[model samples]
Target chain A: MSTIARSPRRAAFFLSDRTGITVEMLGHSLLSQFENVPFDETTLPYLDTEEKAAAVVRKINERASADGLRPLVFSTFVNPQIRFVLDSANALHLDCFSIFIASMEAELGIRSSHAIGLSHRVGQPLDHGRRIEAIQFTLEHDDGLSQRNWQQADITLTGISRTGKTPTCLYLALQYGIYAANYPLIPEDFNRVELPAQFKKLRGKLFGFTIDPMRLHRIRSERKPDSEYASLKNCQYEVRQAETLMRREGIPYLDVTSKSIEELATAVLHQAKLERKIY
Target chain B: MSTIARSPRRAAFFLSDRTGITVEMLGHSLLSQFENVPFDETTLPYLDTEEKAAAVVRKINERASADGLRPLVFSTFVNPQIRFVLDSANALHLDCFSIFIASMEAELGIRSSHAIGLSHRVGQPLDHGRRIEAIQFTLEHDDGLSQRNWQQADITLTGISRTGKTPTCLYLALQYGIYAANYPLIPEDFNRVELPAQFKKLRGKLFGFTIDPMRLHRIRSERKPDSEYASLKNCQYEVRQAETLMRREGIPYLDVTSKSIEELATAVLHQAKLERKIY
Candidate 1:
């Protein structure tokens, strides 16, 4: 009997008229479901013109022929002519907008604007200003550098070093326009029986992050090899002390050893019930 | 004719089993197309359980009844049971997965794993470590704090004050695991006719940013009001000098007067042809 060969690899493309960040994310999430299929992904942003669309079609067709398998194209193009051209490619074209826009128009009884790049446009000047201001605030307040605007902060994160306070705070500010600040819990604070006096009044806005001692030790060791700060004993003591202080002060805390930055930021937003100042 | 009243606003829900970030972004982009319709948006993340889905259904039904318009629900739930429960709600359900997953399965001839929360999971330990390391590297390199690891950076951004350097670098690091660094060009560098000696050798990795003099004046005036740095004449001189140096050095640059942080970062990635180290 003749043997049949099947390739397990497929090509995937994320095309959009704007930055392609949204479509790439959506496509990535969907592709992650098939655990066995390996996808070679490429993103083509600013595909607003029919000529660009035709070029992409050729590329997709070439990839399909080379791989001996059809490629998957995820597109968020708003222009009908561009979308029609993309559909001619020898691949599975998943038009994200066309799939839902018609149904949404029928439900809302209004025609969509069909505007390209509207998703990431600066909608309101005030919202854009707030996002920029929030980033500035977050940067100025990082690692307890300045406490001048502590009262204005939407949320304050406290944790020992390497527990991911800075990245989470930055993500919250960049993604949601939340004025997030972080203060590190150092050795001096751990020795005190009571929470710091400054944190006492700001308990409502305070949140804490804790990590497993072993993971903290490994992470710190990477920064400072063969040091007391990176030793397991110190990591264990610090984590215990930080948890005690947060519990004593009734401030909410999260274990961040196994969480990603996006997960950590979303958890803070949900638990704190902070309103996103920008969309 | 009998009078009929319809609400101008509709309720929109972004539901997911994980952080719900993907669905929220997709829903927001779709809703943004309808400029005249205002949507009161709410995100219900971690809606993996049937009980939570039931509660959300009741909430959606209540909203539809109160507003006299069917609410819009954008869901990324992978579980069939949970999706079924959500579909029964009195709302126009837009299943981000159901719309494409079946077609993808047919095209690829493979059934999806249907695993929940796999979108944002740490797929590879090496990738996770690289992302954390990239963040640390970026933080250490901000504003030319140190030149110890300049060679390790994927891209180095230089600009006059308030040209959106730090946030764009941080976004590159956090979103794409790109080791990005930024250095500010002060008056000393502006006075010189040539590019900085250190950056001259690394011209390929160097990218410049320039902004309108009036905008720079406005931004600086907010921080240090009524100073020479904020003066219109000084702003004009600095802009001219920076652009001249960049042109002389043949280093590519972008204007950040009206671009958002996302747009700026995406442009750098596209123009620089930088490979995203982590997905």
Candidate 2:
């Protein structure tokens, strides 16, 4: 009879010479293939210098010591000096750039311009500029501050406070270059049977967000401790009232209590029929 | 005589039931594989409804007619009703979900969730909360507003005004849950020979951003037209002096004339040897 030990939980690191998003995304996509194995992740970006590489090595070694297994590192370190130091760490390194760069250099019969960069919407500078413009517009028009600019906005988000409003608006703006504005609903506004003055003219552009009262209570408690706003009873009252208002007003809404920001944002875009205006 | 038309500058669309980012990314990656072919793209996201789907079909038909070639659509539409409408369009439809989900269900012997969703990091509510906290922190610490929380930040960005400071910091916070902060360099700081007073205690966490004088002039002129601050001479002066100050201070900086916010944020993390602490 033979005794076998189960595979220990693994630690993974997304290490990059730059923002590390590309490597992280690529690593994540690949790791998702192994659906059965569980993993924990950390991202260490901007690993540009030898000293920094050494520090990362120490951290990796510490993790390896604690876990009794080597960690997996997906790295795009362009500089050879820093890459060499990182390679010395007690972990498995997946080098994304050097292998691909070499093959492309061979195939194209020209040296690659490896001036340390990330993989993104490449060769679309205009699209990227639009994204930045949308982000700026979203920031300027956030939280009912610039309701008059509804003509310029592609979508307007409305909800009671702390129902994942700002993050969704920012996500839509940054990811898709859609000019998004958000408005908060207060308790005083709940008394009215009709929509707000600004929203009266913005029915087609409006989208609402709602959350479970329990989650709202937890979020509010963290934001403001020991207040009427944070009480569970107040949370239930507010959510019930807000949902009723949205339904009566015929505004499309999403319940975000069980959803991440990405999921909430996705539902909003789908239900509101919002197109990405930038790319 | 036979004449070959110039491929009619083929058109492509990324269509989805949600945010369309996944389809866009996948379509772009596949399109990049065909280096010799040139194409124009439009993203039709949130096409979940019958009306929206019909509109997309019309747009696709119009593009095909205008381009004198059949358009290519990369779609992730989940609903059969919307998908049926989109499938009738005059284009080659590459249905992402149907092709993959069917095979996955067959292999796993289970029905896949058909909740129109985009790809993202999942099952990490803790990480999500961290991202929100980092965003709040970054907002509070923007433009040197709250220097008292320097200890809480993983990185601090310094640059001349409008040199892509706030956006990059916010991007880092939102995307990677990195507690990032930014400080603006005014004319007064240009005269100094060393780093600013607040950054004196933050050597390891400091990074810098720079932009080309012409680009800076263009950006500023649009922000404040016909002002001395937007003058080419003033922009050139400030950029030169700012670069010198950063160099003298031994702070690494990048020129942001051509890079997107994504690129800039990535570069800052790589060059600064910064790690995202939130996740």
Candidate 1 to native Cα RMSD, angstroms: 2.5
In angstroms, the error of model 2 at A82 is 19
Q: lDDT tens digits, residues B1-279, model 1?
A: 756775457899999988899899899999989988888999999888999999999999998888888899999999989999999999999999988999999998999989986776643322357677787788899898988968899999988888888888888988888999988888888677776677676679989999989988888898899999999999999999888878878879989887788888888998999998766
Which candidate tops TM-score? 1
lDDT of 2 by residue, A72-182 (tens): 777776676788898898887766555344543443345644455423435243233577678788888888887566768888888888887887888788766788898
Once superposed on the true structure, which residue ranges of model 1 sit more than 4 Å away at CA?
Answer: A1-8, A121-128, B1-8, B122-127
lDDT of 1 at B97: 93
Per-residue alpha-carbon lDDT of candidate 2 for residues B1-279, written as tens digits (9 for 90 to 100): 557665666687888876566666655544554455566877777677999899888989998887777787877676767888888988877765564445434433456445543234453432347877887888789899987778788888888877888778877887777889888888888877666666888777888888888888888887799999999999999988888988888888888887777777777766776765532
Listed in order, each prediction's TM-score against the native is 0.95, 0.71
RMSD of each: 2.5, 7.8
Taking the candidates one at a time, how many backbone clashes does each contain? 0, 4
- State the DockQ, from 0 to 1, for candidate 1: 0.56
Score residue B31 of candidate 1 by CA lDDT: 91
